[model samples]
Target: MSVNVPKPITALEALERAQWIAFAPFVFQAARVLRDRGILLAIERSREGLTLEEVAATAELPIYGTRVVLEAGLGIGLVTEVDGRYRITKTGVYVQHDPMTRANFDFTRDVNYHGIAALDAAVASGKPEGLKVFGEWPTVYAGLSQLPESVRKSWFQFDHYYSDGAFGAALPLVFAGKPKRLLDIGGNTGKWAAACMKHDPDVEVTLMDLPGQLRNAEQNLREAGLLARARFHEADLLDERSAIPTGFDAIWMSQFLDCFSEAEIVSILRRCVAAAGPNCKIYILEAFWDRQRFEAASFCLQMTSLYFTAIANGTSQMYRSTTFLACVHAAGLEVEREHDDLGVSHTLLVCRPRPM
Candidate 1:
């Protein structure tokens, strides 16, 4: 007689099992340190390959520690060893120059590295002890201003991961027929605007951000050869009398809302609605925490929240779609389409002005 066999497990079940199996704190911390330092990128750049001696000389790590680190990286498949020389693996290329790399590094070095260490204190006081941990400014952005220029430049790379895939993925979908005018609020470095212009040559985009961020955005747009297609507007979203141009065919808010309190989000949403005309389409891209999907829980969210609280004086959390829907409703707009990409921490909400 044949024994009864159990049915095959689902993909979701397999993913859950893998997640738990790989959730060691030591492994997580080691990964963070390696990713932050551009170690993988350095290996990739060394076309001639590098040895422990070379790595130690470049990174200023002790010879013994360098060997240990390289070995650990090799075990993790981030590096490949050939004839005693180390090189970056194909899968590791993204971290070397990818936008996600910068974002991840920023979260670890600037935010989580310090914040998580004080989790017990935060829990006891019911208030984040971010400044105490960072020992500098109250906000991450402000604190970054104090770091060496080299360290500060890494954030530009991180901005790519947040905007490139998540925001860029939705543009074609939202602007299927090519809209005439596009407004990008909190548009840092004008990368989203550059992507929009790249996709639709006829589209003229405007980027609105803080004055300092506007300068960076202008430089980026100019470098991307998109200066002709975009204009920079300097204004804080929190300001009541801030001038926001109206009658645009499309309005884009990429990775902007989650930086503030609920009240601030409501105010910004109201302002966004007022800036759009009856026919204007709105696209909102963000990372939201999915309450229903435990597999969807974000390490980026947990880490960034801690970082923002400690360093940027901002708040980062996985917001809910219902919260956004409410904002749309309050603004007299209706959701046209909603797409949530689970693999990456991104959600896209398309909206149109509600009929009077």
Candidate 2:
């Protein structure tokens, strides 16, 4: 069944799924341990299925622990067993090797796991209550720089993996008008800015973000020797008084706007309109859950909203296109064109300021 519709299930089937949900935490941890302990790999490497003892020996784990985890993996469909032997299943292979899965897993484990308990409070208060796991901050963005090293790595890796894939396909569209000056709002790490400059030598790129984020971007650009080619503008996007710099030929916000609520999105876009010139094209790249071509992709996007609630920012979510379009309209901007299925699962909306 597609994510667009809920599957109809028999009573027994519903019970089965309920059971899975009940023990999902244990199954998930078992899968992680199996993947990390090489137990899954051991089974995969065996030309013939491996017996419990053989699997334990090959993976170099205690027999009792290996047996318990392997059985748990079987329930989760990560491994199969017959005739007292076991082998890795397709699901196990994905758990072990899928880059997206790796990114999502690390992000969940390192960034969201500890904080997830506060999701209820976050929902009730309309604030990132789980953010307390890291430090006292209004939102994750404010304290991102001071986050522990592993937490920071997972956050950036997860953030980049989703958005970075879309940039190559987006480059041609952004440069179609040969924009001389491009403003990248929420330009985390300046990856987009660097890409724009590489695509067009004469195009001047500016990255606008908070001071801490700009510091990270500046260091990255400097190490790549692209710092001289970029401009940095420090501003807190949530502060309405922080004026958006003006007169850019192109303005880009990639996977950026979803970090705010509907009202905030409109407020930011209105600012963009005020700063935009008559000829400026505003490009917004986002992963709208409703527009996803695959059920799996849509499911992932929907689940990510939980991260926003408990870890990232409480009030935002992965929106449907209709909801998002309303924000664009409310901001006094109109979408001129749309391009879907950009790399991975992204939709690019080409917009312009609505005429007064």
Candidate 3:
């Protein structure tokens, strides 16, 4: 006699699997605590490795508590265990030593980890707590300078990822034409200029930023063997005295202009128009909100909008492409090209000055 067997019920199985869902918050909170203490870094630096007791001592965690966290980290692939010793994994190395890794962790610890759950308050009130979190700081960029050297290095390191051909693969495309006389407005550290010069040796790139930021840009460009091709101009975006230099073939504004009102953006665009020759091309890259893209909603954008509003009194939501087109029209420019890449919140708007 053959026995009939019943098929496994998928819904019931899924419910059983969901039993651990409630523990997710505790797990995340615990991981954050371990990350802030440099526990992962300590493990990475310890050649010949350290025992659990030693790691606990170095991290100032109680031995039992340290063991529990390390065990969890090991299970999560952040650490490896052989016999009684623990070693850092490849992911661990990236987190501990990689500039981007360090920056991301520090950003999370300083900005996100403390009050991630308070996002509802921001949403409800339409206000950010970043200023409350980081007191007296006019902008996140300004506040970054006040971070500890280790944390600051991490921030800069992570910032490199944006233009380092990781985020949108846009830089490589932008540098392909070998255009001479490039203007990088609000260019932080001149990373894009350095990248441009790296690809095309003949291109001359000028980085314009605030005096303090310009000093850093100068140093960074010089270090990248691009000082000859790159020049630094110190100016504030808001001040008329800080006018952009004229007759550049191409202009770049990356992650800029979002920190201001629509009027301010129009003013800046007008200045860009004045500096641009008839044939000059302008590149404007920024994150924008789209109501149609449901999955595109990101916590980072939510946090940034609130933070910018709270601290800089700047708008954070995506200014629509239509609005940008209007600005281009007001500035006597036309949008020649536009691109929206997958997995990135930014929109690239390429424009050219109108014939007078």
Cα lDDT, all candidates = 0.68, 0.91, 0.67
- The collision pairs in model 2 are none
Candidate 2 lDDT by residue in tens digits, 122-181: 899899999998999999999999999999999999999999999999999989999999
lDDT of 1 by residue, 217-260 (tens): 89888898889988778887666778678878888888777766
TM-score, predicted candidate 2 vs. hidden true structure: 0.97
Candidate 1 achieves a global lDDT of 0.68
RMSD of each: 7.1, 1.5, 8.2
Which of candidates 1 and 2 reaches a greater TM-score? 2
Better of 1 and 3 by TM-score: 1
Clashes of each: 9, 0, 1
Positional deviation of residue 183's Cα in model 1 after best superposition, in angstroms:
0.9
Off by over 4 Å in 1: 1-106, 110-112, 115-147, 291-297
